[model samples]
Target: MTVPAAPFTPAPMPERVTIYEVGPRDGLQNESAVVPVAVKAEMITRLLDAGLPVIEATSFVHPKWVPQLADAAELMGLLVDRIGDAARRMPVLVPNEKGLDRALDLGLEHVAVFGSATETFAQKNLNRSYDEQFAMFEPTVRRARDAGMDVRGYLSMCFGDPWEGAVPVEQVVRAGVRLLEMGAGQLSLGDTIGVATAGHVQAMVAAFAEAGVGVDRLAMHFHDTYGQALANTHAALQVGVTTFDASAGGLGGCPYAKSATGNLATEDLVWMLRGLGVETGVDLDAVVDTTVFMADALGKSPASAVARALAGA
Candidate 1:
């Protein structure tokens, strides 16, 4: 009999990573049942306590679009005092000029604008064509920057679209460049339907780099629909991407894309990163505890394998 082949080797990875926790906003936005403001505030506090430096606090989207997050303003009011002295960054999602106005009114310091790479998703999600969406984003990004708030842009469906299927690498690069040129300080490329493979991840990052977008100014946002988020994260790490987006308890999915599942779990990412000797500055045990608490509130076990194993132990 032939001897077993040697284990596969991974590419080089960064020493440290910035885990951009999006549980409070992207994680909870897709919930059909409304989460109370007090619970939401507690989740944010718990995540901060777990040492997540950058937390996406909430979305200022209209209630008609995301009724689950209708208490965004109230939630912010409750946490404003606690967040003031903390050494953490809280960014809220603002869909348009109106959304930006609401966030600015609350004296928020960081905000994120969302765009779609494919025309089908753009029209379906934002009710605007691809170009029209950028037109809306320009004014919002400029105004947010002028107000001294750091602006982050999210480019959705970067890899594959449920309707369009297999989004072109060039298409994603073009949309990302426009967002950067429009004054977004950072851009998060999203695998909206969780259809991206490790090879796709590597090529997409390379394509963006070739198009003049530095890895430092970019972040990867993956969903685990096909169970590839962690693998995709590994691929991205090899390409020198230091920032990643994850949700606690693996919460949230894309409402528009039925196949989309929960985002990559922060606990899972932390576990993998720790095993690789990567520095995330986040306490993994604390994150597990936080997700357990959130799972209790949501009346279900956490979707994270790491959290589930630790809880059982």
Candidate 2:
């Protein structure tokens, strides 16, 4: 027998939310310009001063792949010196056991392991099969967990895969579940190719939930390629996921997805969420100032309309 559906209802305002600032990592990963370690450290200080809790400081991928972040060790050193015991966290990305060892030597309190939702992205980004890639980082995750560190899981291309087109829901769920079981405190679902729609977002979130994954353990990372990031985010939020990542000025893009573009503007997300009464603990005006600083660093205007308006240029 078919169950009758209740009338549609508006989503209740979220009680609390986590905003992980990814400006230093995702925002700068694709930039052609090589940002100095000092500059990156300063930007991070500015972000923490604005009260963002968890800021992704940098990635430790091979310089061949992301020459922009070659200063990962230096960046980590600077962070430890500047960020004493505080509510803020600056987790660095580790591509393998080597990267993990390097970060552990620096005594980091948090670290992240990156995995992709598709074989194509896994092979393309890390030059390994999905299984092989996960195997490579498994030890890294274990070490971080044993050290009492907060570990985050990132599943790239969660919505769509450039080489494979739409990724099956099973593919993403398998990847997400693996990471969660591997000791990831939060699983950040990345729209790596930036081709996801609201409908797609709804399906993926539902599948993960139905699979018995906790919504609090999930986060959404969207790209505005088709200008659908905010819409996709709204869809995920409607399903009870509370955490979302944003670049201050929408400062990122897919190196793999041709039509994929920048992140949904942090300023815009903050405005909308705050208006909805969500407590993000971020200062909108400070975020605008930092966006302007980031714009100056990028040598272009910020992608955020809200940031631009606040600057009053």
Candidate 3:
């Protein structure tokens, strides 16, 4: 039998990596408070000030589903004058054809669509089976790409599921392939339930590589519910994973994934990456300050340990 070559090298440091700040979109989607559209825009501005490259600004989903993001167009209008030519890309989430149309009307060129890695999660979140939800993404993704927008596809519950329990690695790979084939410029494997281990991270990356998915086109979005997020992220780095989605104060949760927490905090990941000499272009202190600002505006405390520590809280 012949062995295959490795897809990537787990080096101590690579040239650089891109971090997508999803606090405004994924982070606040489940929040009860409307968070005020002005506040949402400011949070995104602050993250960009902290050198975050790409920020998912808002989602054009039905207001009934996520009322907090009801002002998607309002938020984009606010961002237009504030984020002026800074080179920071803000991608809004579009759930269907109508959502994409709304995004295009705002002159938003970058867009993202989400589908589930599990059938059960899909049925609950989108009120449709996996195939149905993903079928919706096909035209949505293509239209975005055709409009010269960068298309990102998110495969939620990649590692485990609240309703169905452990998700198979093959299921994730297949969903990813479908999305990539649909013209998604990048694919994110989301650990929505936050039950994944570092071992699962390694295996999943290898499986995608085996299926011919390039590591460069992949991004990991891990939740810290079980405190395995950073560890799982470390394992992903060892497999040559680079791009990742993070929230400013560890402030996000999946309404679909029961008990899961916010994303792997941007401050924490910045600390780790900077300590290892990997360039993420993020200012750890700035991120901490931004989190503090977020906490004050939301009447809450910063969720990231690094943010609190660096803020001297």
| Candidate that scores best on TM-score | 1
Q: For candidate 3, write residues 1-313 as lDDT tens digits.
A: 1112322334654657899889888888867677988788778888888889888888999998888898888788878877654422578888899999998887777889889988888888889888998788888887888889889999998998877888889989999999999899899999997889999999999999999998999999999989988898788888889898999899889776657778999888887776566788887777888889888888888888887777766
C-alpha lDDT of all candidate models, in order: 0.89, 0.82, 0.84
lDDT of 1 by residue, 112-140 (tens): 99999999999988999999999999999
Q: Estimate each model's TM-score.
A: 0.95, 0.93, 0.94
Q: Give the candidate order by descending lDDT.
A: 1, 3, 2
Question: Which regions of candidate 3 fall more than 4 Å away from where they truly are?
Answer: 1-11, 85-88
Give candidate 1's root-mean-square deviation (CA, Å). 4.3
Looking at model 2, the pairs that clash are: none
Which residue pairs does candidate 1 place in steric collision? Answer: none
The TM-score, computed over Cα atoms with residue i paired to residue i, of candidate 3 is 0.94
Which stretch of 10 consecutive residues in model 1 shows the poorest summed lDDT? 1-10
Best by lDDT: 1
lDDT score, residue 1, model 3? 15
Worst 10 residues of 3 by lDDT: 1-10
Give the C-alpha lDDT of model 1: 0.89
Compose the digit string of candidate 2's lDDT tens values, residues 97-209: 88888777777778898899888788978889989988987888998889888899999988887788888998899999999998899999999767889888888888998
